[model samples]
Target chain A: MTAMQEGAHVPSVEESDEPKMRDVFSDVPTDTGLATDPAGVVIAELGDADPRILTLSADVGVTLAEFRSRHPERYIEMGIAETNSISVAAGLAASGFVPYVFSMSAFGVLKTAEQLRTGAAYNRLPVRLVGRLTGLAMGFFGTSHHAVEDVAVARAITGLSVVAPADAQSVISLMRATVDREGPVYIRIAEDAQPVYAEPPTYRPGELLRVREGADVTLVGHGMGVGLALRAAARLAEEGVQAEVLDAAWLKPFDAEGVVASARSTGAILTIEDHDVVGGLASMVAEAVGRAGVAAALGSIALPDERLEVGVPAQLYERYGLTVPNVAAQAKALLGR
Target chain B: MRVDTAPPATTPAPSDGDDGGPTLDRGRSITPVELARRADWIRLQTIELIDRAGLGHYSSTFSSAEVFATLYYRTLRLRPSDPAWPDRDRFLLGKGHAATGLWPVLADLGFFPTEWLDTFGTAGTALNDHPDMLRAPGIDFSSGSLGQNLSVGTGIALAGRLQERDYRTFVLTGDGELQEGQVWEAVMAASHYRLGNLVAVVDANGFSGSGPTSDAMGIEPLAARFESFGWAVREIDGHDPEALLSAFDTLPDPSAEQPVCVIARTRKGKGVRMMEEAPQAWHLGHLGPDLRRQVVEEISGRMP
Candidate 1:
């Protein structure tokens, strides 16, 4: 926990009962009672499980420093050519082995999108693309590093599954489900978010999960948005407003059934994500709810359609409506509080 | 309009013509005359398939007919019976506009039924404008966009080392396709990995979809460029299977730890008289019955 040691020196923002409350977003995340690793190191489970699995890196494999040392035989250091790396990953997949192509979200998903669409998804090769520093995770790396359009771009490709995980446990769970799954997949991983699950949980894309239960309103979340929703749910409870928080669970093969049911159960819903509202989970859920005609008042908190700024993670999350209080306020407004 | 009505001044594989045309230099399973005849046949089928489809890459296919003839018939090590043989050498046509020329070659070798060619370019047909390994049996990788094949070839070469398979990978690329930056990335990777098992054959047909390769975006000193990138380079007349085979012989040994690139300099259109003459018009054009008959007669007359 890098945050705890230096956190005392910097005057805290809204000091909490919890020890070492640093809003600077350092190595240690605010714990969410979930048994999650801070390093986002669960992908090594994929390396350990399948002998045919290989790790393809476009100069960003350094992110998987632990996996490389553990599975030295299965690592391929690719050049900075993102498009070429995708094609090469597809070639490896075509040769009867699964290759997890890794790069920063901006580089992996946005830059190499065409090659992935043509080479992997169109061809239905089982090439897993693990995009790191998704959303605004790379705040200090500038707007180019932020992958705001990753989910939207990945969803358009046929036979490509887009999975955005909230934390390390969700990553492991998603990997467990997709390890033997056929076809191409893009995993937009959150580097380090607060631990939410009590233990590591496995998931199926069709099976939606409810993090916290309430009947007054539904706070729908995708990826790290779920962590904010959970925190918002706790805050709203103190205000005598019960909010039900839900994780999108799956992005591409979305849980329309669960989404419609949640909207119906609570006449008010607010969808939130660290991506653009235009094509991200918020848009998908809104469309589904509208088509189902659930009669629920739907609102969304998402990134503006523009380049984001570089700063500490907390400051960027604050500028965007991607924090607990922001979620709580949006939920209250959606419910006419 | 007619660039060159006489025979192409250069051939990929040079020949010592005694009096008439190319004579067999190697007493082999596929003689030079036989190779020339097969190339001619492939060209005829290329026009026939494209004519049936009402539109296709005529010049692109005609330019590399000998390339298909040489690799499948002479240079490549393939088990026609076992199309999915893991140990088989892989061939990918990066300039996949030339795929119509390859369909007949794969069918000739029994990779699929010849009747499959009939449904080509149809609504539900497997054969589209580019090659798909899923639908077609012998195509090693699916390719449509240029600049990707080199990377795929490099991965396949590296996969051979990982999977412990002793299979060599060959890629056929358009000269103009080199303008793509990804091709250079693959070139750099091939050299970095020292993938001696990989061989890239450039179909220097001198014309992209728009016009002459030089006019579109000149990527000249092609051989010198590859040499600078640490690839073992060789330049040859692309229309000659004899030359392609000879160049194939000089490829770096698999254990030599140096990748080889053979630049097969070729005409935009080698077999058909009209396509060879017209630089820009026939890159993509329908072959009318009258023109088809005339081109067929010319190719038939030139059958060596």
Candidate 2:
């Protein structure tokens, strides 16, 4: 870490000149055919819309550098300070520019939460915050890096739309919707490779995508847990216990109607999330069920309210009962089947 | 109509006409006696609103009455009709305890209805103990947590330079609130960025929550510290309208080397005679009916 000297002129470091680090996933082609995929789909869509997207990130200059190379004058490298980055993005929005500020979820959303609340949500400024390595994605980075409280914090704030994309295609669609949306939005992205669930024009905020429809039990999940929920549904189907799967992409202004309808259709409900059970997806869905006056028994598969010891991401998920089998078992127990 | 550029005179005389008031020859002009009287009426309104709602930081608010009077009444190029105007100057109240002072100033400046002051601190009222930019009109940013405003102000200043706007940004912080680590982080960034367009004023009222700042944290030799951090430091009597105006006036040219800091030493409970030199607890203590009447009389006599 470079120390900034007091009373000295600190020149802005040129991020483009730095050597690039290899992207985590190599098998995933740069060009994915889905409309919301990373390479061509979202970029092409944005390119056709008068090209109003501006990408900015802290410390992750390589990603911004790539975007800048593709879309010159539309990218800014804000360096290591996340608070300044968010505030500048708010200012940029005030000037009629659409800025997507990228940083680690912990620093990007939680560290500079006050700025996002005052500058963007309160002022109704249009800035999309894209936080990478959300939840347990930074598995090896220990507790300090994991952003388990982002969902809760973002939900507490008003006028901020919070979305967690399950895969690359969903990410593209959510990003597209967030850019066109007139208010502040936070998009949490996983660091690892996500399984593609949909093709084109499938995801939208406040709309729950029913990945699998059934009546025995409703399994609702978001972010990386969406894939786990689908797997659990498949396993339950083999056992002749039909389970409905709902992808709750948007966490705030949640799909209350969809959740209520599913709970009424199915006699039981289970919520799976890679966050704390206290204030995350589980609590949100439970609130909706209670408000809808649904009599269905509900269970939540989530991390216990304790600091997770350092370990691999997959092991942590399994240890915290966030895996497919864990969710399926919880749903079975709720259904008493 | 062309706005008057002259500062208010130091004759300590009251005026009768609405627009005909004292004019000063130097500094970012002060509010004339007529305007000061109008401001006093607004201040009285604010006091009534807080007292009725049973919430306010009356002592800190009273200390900066003259500063608020000058800024909202004379200085600042603001459009009350359009609070979100992109080119307007930014005013960030770091020590948000002075929110009571701001409500009346904003009302007088026509940012919101003057009658809204009565709803201050009431349930569902836009006016609260601290300034919320979302709820209140003309508040650039919501600030209550100490030491965060300077960083936010620095961000705004950087944005102004990047966008090439001539608008200036001013942040007011408390002397005791400067203990947070984030304050130093912002101070370093602002001076390193050479934010001459940013001017920070420290309301050095000696006392914190417990007692005098020296007794609490000892932030003595404050001006030299700012100077060492690459800021042009100025010390002034915060209670004197002339001194405050002088400090605000003669701001360093944007082409200069660093940001500016004005350490304005003031009394915590400035106006009310009984509480003028009282302890920090009086910062928010209620002024009883008898004390209120006495305060009114003191303010009326001191108006000229």
| C-alpha lDDT score of every prediction, in listed order | 0.78, 0.72
Worst 10 residues of 1 chain B by lDDT: B1-10
Assign candidate 2 its CAPRI class.
Answer: incorrect
The candidate 2 chain B region of ten consecutive residues with least summed lDDT is B17-26
lDDT of 2 by residue, A1-337 (tens): 0011123222223544432223332222323453222632454457457455667667765445446667765666666777767766765566566778878787788887887887778778777887777777665577997788888898888998999887777777777777778678888875443464655447656878888888899988888778788888889889988989888888876898888888889978888777777788888988998998888888887766777645556556656766677777777888876
Q: For each predicted model, how many residue pairs clash, with residues at least 3 apart or on different chains?
A: 5, 3
- Candidate 1, residues A66-121, lDDT tens digits: the string is 67888987888886878888888888887888888888787788888888888888
Error of 2 at A198 (Å): 4.5
Per-candidate iRMSD = 1.0, 3.3
Cα distance off (Å), candidate 1, residue B151: 1.0
Top lDDT model: 1
Docking class of 1: medium
- lDDT per residue for candidate 2 within B1-304, as digits (tens), equals 1112123342222222223222211223345455455445544655676677775677787767766766665556676667877666788899987887788677755689978877877789888788988789888887887777887787677667766787778889988888875677678778877889888888888887678888878787999889999999999887776776667766776556589998888888776666666747677767667767677677666666
Any runs in candidate 2 off by more than 4 Å, and if so which? A1-56, A68-99, A113-123, A180-183, A198-200, A235-241, A321-337, B1-49, B118-126, B254-257
